[model samples]
Every structure is written in C-alpha cells, then in structure tokens.
Target: MRVLWKIEMWCRKQAAAAILPLLLVGWLTGESSQALTTFGKSNTQPPKEVAPTAPPARPCSRQAECAGISSSSCVRTHYDSVTRCLCGDNSPPLNGQCEAQSKLLYHVCANSDECNDGLVCGAPNITGNAQPHLRVLTPQDKICLCDTESGYREREYTCSDAEILKTSIFAIIFVTSLRKILFY
Candidate 1:
C-alpha cells in the first residue's frame, strides 16, 4: 500500500511539472493573440496608397538649381569636371536621393564624416606603412579605421594610449634587468 502511494505521488508530481509549462505557454499564447487582436486593424480594411513623387533634376551648375530636390547639392565630378546635382559629402546618391552609409568600423566610406566617432575613412595602416599600389588608390577604396591620434590603440583594440606606453616601458625595463642579471 505504501509503495503504491509513493508511485502515485511521483506520477502526480511528474504530471504537474509537465502540465504547468503547457498551461503557462497556452495562457501566454492566448494573451498575446488577444492583445494582437485588440490592437491590430481588421483584415477587411485595405492599406492606404501613397502618391508618387516627381524625379529630381540631374544637371545643375549651382546649388540653387537643385534646391527643389531633397538632400541634393551641386558638386563637380573629378573625372569629367562637370558640375551636377549630387548628394551631400557624407551621403551617397541611391535610386535618386542621398542615402546615409554605415559609420561603423571596417565599413566602406568616402570621407571621414562617413565614419563613426574616433574613426577615419582611409587605408587600415595606422603606421603609414601602406603599399605603393595602395597609396595611389581612390577614396572609394578606403575603409573606416581607428583614429590612432585620438588615443585609440589598434594593437590592443582599446581606447587607451597610455597602456601601450606602459607596456613598452615595462618591456624595456624587463630587458635591461634580464641583461644585468645575465652579465653580472
């Protein structure tokens, strides 16, 4: 009788453990569905249509000519020496308007303004050791890199410049001490 009671109790505990999660999941799902139904629009309604806008003018000799277009300005192209309506310095023209590029590290950039804080758009070499072929490359080839002058330590991937100095000083002291111990 005691053995049967123990087995019954174990079964009851196992059943409760299994049923509790199912009940919780069902309750949560029901609540989420109810919330969605309460807040969402009816399926019978149609989405509103948006009016199409006129395309921006392409050719321009002055910024005033492109004033009608959003996020556009007049700039001279380096290749053809022709002044035309273009995007801002940091933004690139995409599909007819200026689009902002990602300013994160390692992302392709055209100028420093397109890069995040403490980063610059240039060759990755912080030591000025870029190859001759790479040196003649255009701005489009450049990428966002850490601005070492701003206290960014690329070797340690940190923003502390003092850490590198301390490390170098420690290395010099260690070498001198080792030399003294070996010679003397």
Candidate 2:
C-alpha cells in the first residue's frame, strides 16, 4: 500500500503549509494589539473644530483680474470714506465713468458767479456733440459764467446782488480810509 502512504504524506504537507501562514498572521496581530495600550494620543479621538477658526473670505469672480486686485491701485478706492471696489485708472475721479482722458474740475457753484476769481465751475463746452450748447444748470437767466479757457481769468460773481454789494461796500470803505490816512 505504498500508493496509499504517498497520498497521506501529501495531505499532511498541505495541512502544515496552510497552518504555518495562519500562525504567522496570528503572531503579527497579537504584537499590534499590544502596541495600542502605549499609543496614548494616537488611540484617542480627534480635536473639535471649535467655532470654525475664522469667517470665510470673499471669493474672486473674474480670472483676468490681477492677483490681490482688491489692494491694487488699479481697483482700490473708497465710497464716501468707506472702502469700495477699485473703480478705474488711477486719476482724480471724473464723474463715475472714471475716464483717464478727463479730470474732475473742483467746483463750487454750478455757475461762474458761485466760484472764486481764480477758479471756475461749469459744464463742459460741448460743441462736438449733436446738441451744441453750454449746459444750462445755473439760476442766472440760463447763463453760466464761471467757466474759463486755459490762459484767461474770468471775474467770478454770485447769483445774489446782496453779496456783490457787500464786497463793494467793504472795498470802498477800506480804500477811502487808506486814502485819508495817507493824505493826513
């Protein structure tokens, strides 16, 4: 029965091979479990989120906008003293369009009478437009006398005659007083 003996030997070899792997795996698992007791923080749960740290930042929409565009001079600005979106080319505010070609004329009254002698205030002399006329926004019979050309200075007056009279009286008094003092 040598054939029967050979079959029995083969079965015994297979059983030993399978049992050896299972024993090795059991040994590894047992070693790992022993490590858990000494793991300390590693074995514990994670820390809490705790108020989410900080508020979410505003996201940028346009890709073409430069990096840090909010702080960049090109887009940076203020609205009535409050920080605002950067509007246009870096120049004095010219209306809302913020055209680099134009400038904001520091004005007082809508008419020339409301501004100072050296200064002027009025709408643009729009002759190139389809409707060619000086913009009529003042109360002086549709007249706007404040605006001037590059080299000439215009006499600035006011809408009220009382103001003009007051200045005239002051000038006359000062001149007459100076003349008397000088002569006497």
Candidate 3:
C-alpha cells in the first residue's frame, strides 16, 4: 500500500508537469487568435504623407557671422546691397551648399586656392611667349599647375623620384635602340 501511494503521487506530479505546458500553449494560442480576429475587423488607414521643409536662410553682415557655414564668407550680393553668407573663393555653391573645388592639372580655376595640393592656378604659355606672371584675373585662362616653389617644375604634374627614374630609363633605351637601327 505504501509503494502504491508513492507511485500515485509520482504519476500526479508527472501529469501536472506535462499538463501545465499544454495549458499555457493553448492559452497563448487563444489570445493570439482573438487578437488576429480583432485586428482583421479594425479599420486601417493609409499612412499620411509628410511634406519636406526647406532650411532657414542664413544671413550675415561680416565674415565672422558666416563662420558657422563651411567654406563661406559674408559678401555683398552683386544684384543687391545686402551682405549674405556666400561660398569662399575656393568653393562654389552647389545644391544650396558651399562645395570646395578640386581642380586637376591644367583644369580651369578661379584661384590657386581652388587647385589641389602642390598645384597653383596659372595660365599656360601656349603661344610660346614669355611666361606670364601668375594672375587670377580670367577664369578661362587659369589652370592648375605644378607649384614651382615646392620643387615642382612647370608642366610637370608628378614629382615622384621613382616615376622620374623609370621615365629616364625608358627614354635612354628608346634612344639607343633608335641609334642602333639607324647606324647599323
């Protein structure tokens, strides 16, 4: 009788352990089904569209006032007397923002500041005339050039010693090959 009672208690505990999880699963499923039914019957509206807002205009009276804006300065408008925040000499306004201009070799530029590092904006001596002094007057004539003060000679875009050595070797080989073919 004692053994039978112990076995009955163990069976009861086992049944409770198994039934508890099943009951919890059924409760969860019923709750989810009720939620689904309610969701289906509820009126759903389309999302409202939002309009984009433009940024507020920034006005300035002095260069310091334009310091918050990147690459900008206060300048009087050509059409109006009012001074406004405008892009600096090295930058131009694009898409309502000041953008720095990066001019490549021989590319037209407004000033030397617009040219990339190790380059200066100047006019090329295309007519074989005496090299003109560096000027920033005409945009059409200005181009990015090697900075002579940085040990870069005029018309040279690269200052790498390895590239120079390779070019010299190739030139020497070409010249010797041409001489051999001509004299031999």
Candidate 4:
C-alpha cells in the first residue's frame, strides 16, 4: 500500500508540473492578445523625445587665430509660399526656410531674433511669415565666429555668450553652483 501511494503521488506531481507550463502559456497569450487589442500594435519600443545635450564650447588650436569664421548675414534665396527672409548663405541655416542641404549641421539658436545663441524656437505654419519654423542649424552651419577661449573647446551647449554683461551665463553658473553647494 505504501509503494502504491508513493507511485500515485509521483504521477500526480508530474502531471501538475506538465499542467503548470500550459497554464502559464495561456496566461501570457491572453495578455499578449489583450495588449495588441488595446494599443494599435504591440508595445516594443519607448517614445523618443529630443533632449538638449550640453554643447561644448568652441575651441581654438595653436595655429588657428580665428575660432570660427563669421559671415555678415545669411540671406534667404527662396520660399514656396510661406517664407519671407532673403538669406543667401548656405552655411548657417535659418528657421522657417528649407535648407539647401540636409546633411549639413547647424547650431541651435534661441530664436531668429537671437539665433546666434542656442534656442530652438519652433517654426511657423501660417502664411506671410518668411520662415515656417525655426530652422535651427548645427554649429558647422554657423558661418562666422570670433576666437574661442583656451582650455574650453568651442562647445555649442545651451546658448552661452562672450560677454557676461550681454547675457546670463554668469548668473546661471553662480546660482546653480550656489544651489549645489548649499542644498545638495
């Protein structure tokens, strides 16, 4: 009787082990179907957002007297129906206008009002305004620049300025440092 009971228990245990995997499969399949029904497709990838990386300061090497070349102004050559500016330079791209080249890099200026600084103002969609959107360019697109500082390579981070009086890199750095020291 004891051997018979042992045999029955072992068989039951094996049966349960086989059944559990089937149960788990059913659950996972149900979940997958429900997920597909809810979202248009299965969730495989997360959404991507544009993040602002700290742009390195522009750097000047030993031989280079000029940090970056400067152009007098960028003039636009054409706009289908919405754009208005008369910029001609292909180097620095302007907002709201189609770039002559797509692969060329341009810097992120704050706005057309102050694009020399790094700000990504959106482009416009309506009529009459020359630029449809802010055609933020990569630094390579910037045509002209003064000599950059030593030790700090010309990085196109969040817009920084040459003169402390002109912009707020001083105040921002000071306040951020103070907060870090006092609170952190």
Query: What is the per-residue lDDT of model 1 for residues 18-63, given as tens digits with 9 covering 90 to 100?
Result: 6555544555466745544655566676788988654533755544
lDDT of 3 by residue, 31-89 (tens): 74555456447557687898765443365543456556665544443343444555643
> What C-alpha root-mean-square deviation, in Å, does candidate 1 show against the real structure?
18.1
Worst 10 residues of 1 by lDDT: 131-140
The global C-alpha lDDT for each of the candidates, from Candidate 1 onward, is 0.54, 0.37, 0.54, 0.35
Q: In candidate 1, which residue pairs clash?
A: none
What are the runs in model 2 whose C-alpha is more than 4 Å off?
A: 1-124, 129-165
Error of 2 at 3 (Å): 99
| RMSD values, in order shown | 18.1, 37.5, 26.7, 20.5
RMSD of candidate 4 to the truth, in angstroms, is 20.5
lDDT of 4: 0.35
For model 4, how many clashes? Answer: 38
Error of 1 at 175 (Å): 36
**Candidate 1, superposed: residue stretches over 4 Å from native:** 1-101, 126-140, 155-184
lDDT, candidate 4, 70-166, per-residue tens: 3212222233222122222333323333343221112222334433332223332234542322232222333222123322223431223355443
Global lDDT for candidate 2? 0.37
Clashes of 3: 0
Candidate 3 is scored at a TM of 0.26
TM-score of 1: 0.25
